[model samples]
Target chain A: MKIGIMSFAHLHAEAYIQNLRAIPDVELLGIADDDAARGEHFAQAFNARYFDSYAALLSAKPDAVLVCCENSKHRALVEMAADARVNVLCEKPLATTLTDARAIIEACERARVKLMTAFPMRFSTPLVEVKARLDANEFGRVYAFNATNQGEAPLQQRAWFVNKDLAGGGAVMDHTVHLADVLRWYLQSEVVEVYAQTNRILYAKEIQDTRVETGGLLMLTFANGVFATIDCSWSKPPYYPTWGGLTFEMIGERGVVLVDAFKQNLTLYRHDLKRAAWNSWASDANQAMVEDFVAAIRDDRPPRVTGYDGLRALEITLAAYESAERGEPVRL
Target chain B: MRVGIVGAGSMGVVHAASWQQTPATLAGFFAESSHDATRLAEKYNARVYKNYAALLNDVDVVDICAPTHLHHDFVLQAAAARKHIICEKPLARTMAQGRAMLDACRNANVKLLVAHVVRFFPQYALAKQNVANGSIGTPAVVRLARESARPKRPPNNWFFDFEKSGGMLLDLMIHDFDYARWLAGEVETVFAQSIATENPDAPLDFGLAILKHKNGALSHITGAWAFPPPNFRTAIEIAGDAGLIEWKSADTAPLEFFLHERAGDFPDVGLPSSPLREDPYTTQLQEFYDALLNDTPTRVTAEDGLAALQIALAAIESARLGKPISLAEARA
Candidate 1:
């Protein structure tokens, strides 16, 4: 399978590149970014060719392209890919607005091409096992979910993340969609209502231009009667071990299942580094996600995480933003 | 000082044990159930009063650890008897009741101390002290989580009744609400989401509340009553311009600090080497007794309790209305 990357705006693009390279049968064609310097820098560092424009990369005839542009730029890139009749595996959130999200899905559907959202958590080993247990009725009917997806401010890696226009919103847009997709997948339910609150508290002093919210908490009620809370915040401090973490507790009729996606880590206190760090030895979820995407293309089938799945998750996230803005719960 | 405890359940027993470590004498206790009152009195080597009024006549201090719905009546009767009062949190189920309780205490010239015990926990106390000292610069954000097993009470337990206990938001999460207000000042607005199992056969509740503080800080508060027994955990994070401070009950390490580069010269932050042997409940009771004896101010005043209750009630209202409630609007 031949794959190209569309933009390097998101830091995850670096990890996805490694994931693509590790697959024995996969070919990494090259990378493209509007910013010439950033595109060339990574292209050279990874020993790959650089395309100055997204269109130039699409012209290379890759089987699929990974969209890693800023959230607000996703719709344009995905539409461009749809026009080229290329398969796509866009990053999480799909797009900033529901209109843009729907447009991306519609374009892909019209072209009869596969469009997948990059939800690596679906491939996380522990979470996968938990889901299997739920499917097997190991915990009985799930009653509720308490989840958290937290990370450090993205300003350290990409300043555009804190910019409202570039990133859509803040932590709500960045983190909520991941868990939203996971819960929907796990319970096979659709969120019917959303209530959210957000604030520009975590990075108020660190960044000035962004009017986005850095902290957010969302409450979602599903059609199946299960309710969940998602604490999506950029509250992690810079010097902490890793950038952030994901954890959840799922309550059910028979028992409760707890999962920490990044728990398989060794805490290191190194004098040379002058700071503590968490060295993760966990199975690479990104690698699994990339493999799944490649297999879906090879089999001429839709990816396990499809664009509609992305649309659904994006809907919940966007509703959360609307709820925050209107100060009320939004019905799906 | 003679302390008469109202209610002979878990909180009453806890208060009884803590008072034993103080200078106050355990005069007696009143309970709706004679069996519970007798059992508790036997264990504490105290008397069992047949009625609340009789208990009030026998002691100088009335410690109201009864069901939340009864707090208003207990407080009013105690105030009428001119006794110093120590009430368990939520002060009352409604703001009107809380106001009346506060007013009655004030008019009688008796100290009213509400048990917001998180303020007395050594770990929490140290964090508050550091914040007050401006160790982390100007506080900007706060997050708190308290999780515990669903209370397995008899069918007749009032806690299972939302109307009487105010559900999980007012009963359990009010601790974090009080702590957040104590750290970040008054809340300007609140939005929340919550779920209580409608099926009486499966009893559990979870709540998440977001408070936008008047000081430009924001607080994310989460409480869960879905875990199994012997599985209580609490975690807190406070972020400011200069750095962050974090603590978790499940982690072996003490409170951790990650100061910004500009704060490199600040003193090393460390938790107390030896954990304080005193129970926080005992410490809080001691503080309350000392204030009364020394004619000093109580650590958690009636006004503080009232304010925290107001926020909790507002959060409940927000959850009910499916909208955020401004504190100003709620007050009006």
Candidate 2:
């Protein structure tokens, strides 16, 4: 299977490039970016071809492509890929607006190309195991979820995360999508209402220009009468060992399960780094998500994480922002 | 000073043990249900008071460990008797009850300390002190969680009643609510979601709350009565602009605080303890004694207890109404 990557804007692209190369039969054909220097730098560093433009990459006619541009810039690149009849796996928060999200989904459906959202948590090993138990009636009925998706401010890796026009919003847009997607998948329910609170006190001075929220707490009510909270904040400080992690407690009538999706690690107190560091030894969810994307294309089926899933999660995100602004619960 | 311990249940014994070590003498025990009242009174070399009024009259201070519905009467009577007070957490079952108790204490000119013992836990205590001392810079975001097995209550135990104990939100998570306010000023609003409390037959209860502090900080709190026996855990993570502090009650973490264990012999009675051999409960009550003796302020004031109750009650209301309750509206 051959695939190309569009843009090097999202830092996840670097890891995705590594994952593609790790697959036995997968070919990372090239990387394309409007930022020529960035495109060329990653292409050379990872030993792949460099395409100067999205049109050029699409014209190359790889079987599929991954979009890793800014959150708002996803639409144009994805549409162009679909127009070229290329299956696409778009980075999370699939688009900044509901209109854009809808348009992106419609573009893929119109062109008869597969569209998957890059939600790796759906493939998380620990989450998958508990989900299997949840399906087998081992827990009877799930009652509520207490979850968190926290990380350091991404200014060092990708500065665009703090830019409102490019990123859509702050922590709510950046971190809410992953767990929102996971909860909807595990519970197989639609969120009916959202109430959220956010604060900018943590990183206002660090980010300098944007007053976008650095800390956010979101409460979601599902159609199944299940409710959950998402601490979707980029509030990790500089000394944190790793980027951060995703964790949740799922409560059921019979039992409860607590999951830390990223807890498999070896901790070392290293003198060189002058801090305790965590070296992860866990299975990579990004790799699993990509493999699933590849299998869906081979089997000619929709991916496990579809564009509709992305749209639904984005709906919740938008509703959360409205809820926070209006100081009330916003119904979906 | 003489400290009369009320209610001879698990917490009653726990308090009796702690007060024995304090400078104050243990006055006696009083309980309608004498599961361990007689043994405990003997163990402390104290007599058993036949009634609440007799206990109040005999002791200079009253430490009430009764169920939620009994707290209002116990504290009011204790205050009326001109005794200093140390009441078990939740302070009262409802906002109005809490307010009335605070008012009574003020009118009687008596000192009342709510046993929010989490404040005295070394980890949390240090976290609050560090945040105040600029160790983590200005507090930006806080995550707190406390989950313990459903107490093996008698069939009619008020812990399971939403009106009497407020389920897990008022009885369990209120500890974190008070701690959150202590770490990051007063809260401005509360938004929450809960599960299973509405279903009387459900085996477990869970609650998640988001507190927006007046200082522009956000705190995400999770509390549950869902684990099986002997399975309980708590976690805390506070992120500020300069640094972050995180701890969890697990084998791998530095802290080994095993609170509220229904220990051997008294399979249904609690002996909340820390591996550090430090009893936060004792520390809490000792400070209460200091406040009464020195005529100074204690760590948890009656107003602080009232403020925490306001947040918990607001959380319960928000969970039921599916809306965010501003502190102004919650106050009203």
Candidate 3:
């Protein structure tokens, strides 16, 4: 399988590139980014070719491409990859808008190429075990879910993250989609309505330009009567543990299940770093996601996480924004 | 100070024990069932009043630990008797009731202290102090979770009645709601989702409320009554520009701090590790007693209790209406 990365915008791209290189049967074709400096830097660092233009990378005829462009730029790159008939594993929040997401999916369908949305939480080992238990009906009827996906502000790593136009929105856009996709998959239910509250409080003094929200809480009601609360916020401090964490409590009739996706970590208090940091020694969810995407193309099968799945999650995330704006729930 | 307690249930027992530790005399207590009142009074070496009014007449301060639905009447009676008041959380079930209670206390010119014991918890109190001291910079976001087993109530207990207890949002989550409002400012809007497995044979309840603070802060408040007995856990995370403050009951370590400064000892600042010999309940009662003796204002005022109640009620309404409720609309 030949896999090329579209852009080096999202920080996840760095880890993903490593995962791609580690796969035995996979050939990492090259990297492409409109930002020539970033593209060239990563390419040189990884010992891979750098394509100045996305089209030039597609000309190499890679079997699949990982879309790591800005949130707002996902649609264009996915459409381009689809036009070239290359399967794509797009980063979370498929696109900034439902229209763009639909266009991306439609383009892929028209070109007869597979489109998978990156949702690595579904591949996290602990969450995988939880999903397995849920599948076995060990929890009976799930009553509610309290989940959180939190991270530090990405301003230091990706300045575009706080830029609404480039990143789509702040914490809500960046974090909500991951858990939204996971909940939908785990419960096998569609969200019927969404209500959200958001704020730009975290970086009010430091951030003067962006209109994005740094903290947000989304309430979702699923069709199956299960309700969930997702706390998606860029509220972690820079010197804290690892970048972020994902955790949840699932309440059911028979029993309750608590899961911390990033709990397999060792905490080290570093005097030089001047902070206690969580070093995660858990299985690489990103590696599993990359392998799944590659195996789907190699096996001539649909990726476990599809473009439509992305669409549904994106719809919830977009509705959350709308709900926050209107100060009311938005029904799907 | 002579103290009288209403409702000889678990909370009443807790209040009685705490009051015993204070300089106040446990004059008497009243309950719907004389059996419970007598049992609790005997344990505390106090007398059991025949009725609420009798207890009110005998005491200088009225401590209402009654069911939530009875709070309004108790407050009105205590205020009419011109006694200082200390009431357990969720001041009243409805907004009108809460407002009337607040007005009555104000009109009677007596100190009205609501038992929002969470504010007295060392972990939470330290977090608030740190925020006030600008240790974490200006607070931007807060995530709070309180999980406990279903309350062990006798048959026909008011807690099981939605109208009486206001379900988990009022009965269980009101603590987080009050603490959130205390940490952040006034709530501008609330969006909530809840689930209740109300079957007598299989009881479970969960609630999540998102409060968008008027000051641009955001809070995610979660409460659960689905865990099995002897299991109660709470976790809180506050994030701001300079750093983050986190505390979890499941963690063996003290409250964790992660500041952005990178050239000092790990954690930068440390919280006291020694546990307080006094319980939060006792601390709260002692504070109330001191305020009464000094003729100073109580830490948590009637107005603050009213504000917390308003948020809780709005969250409940939002969950029922399947929408977010604006504080302005709630006031109107």
DockQ for every model comes to: 0.35, 0.74, 0.58
User: In candidate 3 chain B, what residue range of length 10 has the lowest lDDT sum?
Assistant: B265-274
Displacement of residue B272 (Cα, Å) in model 1 is 19
Model 2: DockQ score = 0.74
| Residue lDDT tens for model 1, A85-110 | 98899998899888999999999999
Clashing residue pairs, backbone N/CA/C < 3 A, model 2: none
Query: Candidate 2 docking category?
Result: medium
Candidate 2 lDDT by residue in tens digits, B1-332: 98888888778888888887789999899997765788898788898988888888888989999988889999888888888888998888877788889889999998788888889888889888898899889888899988876677677877777778888888888989999999998999888888664455566778888888988889999887777666567888898888888887764355554577655423452223456664887787788888889987777888888888889989888888777788986566
Q: Which of candidates 1 and 3 is the stronger one according to TM-score?
A: 3
Top-scoring candidate (TM-score): 2
What digit string (tens of lDDT, one per residue) describes model 3 on residues A1-332? 88899999988899999999999999999999999999999999989999989999999999999999999999999999999999999998899999999999999999989899999988999999989999998888898888899988888898898888998888999999999999999999999988887878777766655688888888888999998989898888776678888988888987578888998989888889887788889999999999999988888899899999999999999999998898778999
- The alpha-carbon lDDT assigned to residue B183 of candidate 2 equals 92
**For candidate 2, what is the total of clashing residue pairs?**
0
Docking class of 1: acceptable
Write the number of the candidate with greater DockQ, choosing between 1 and 2: 2
Question: For model 2, what is the C-alpha lDDT against the true structure?
Answer: 0.87
Candidate 1 yields a Cα-based lDDT of: 0.86
Tell me each candidate's TM-score.
Answer: 0.90, 0.94, 0.92
Q: What is the per-residue lDDT of model 2 for residues A1-332, given as tens digits with 9 covering 90 to 100?
A: 88999999999999999988888888988999999999999999998999888898888889999999999999999999999999999999899999999999999999999999999998899999988998998987888888889998887888889988899989899999998999999999999988888888777886765657888899898999888889998877667888988988888877787799988999978889999888999999999999999999999988999999999999999998998889888888
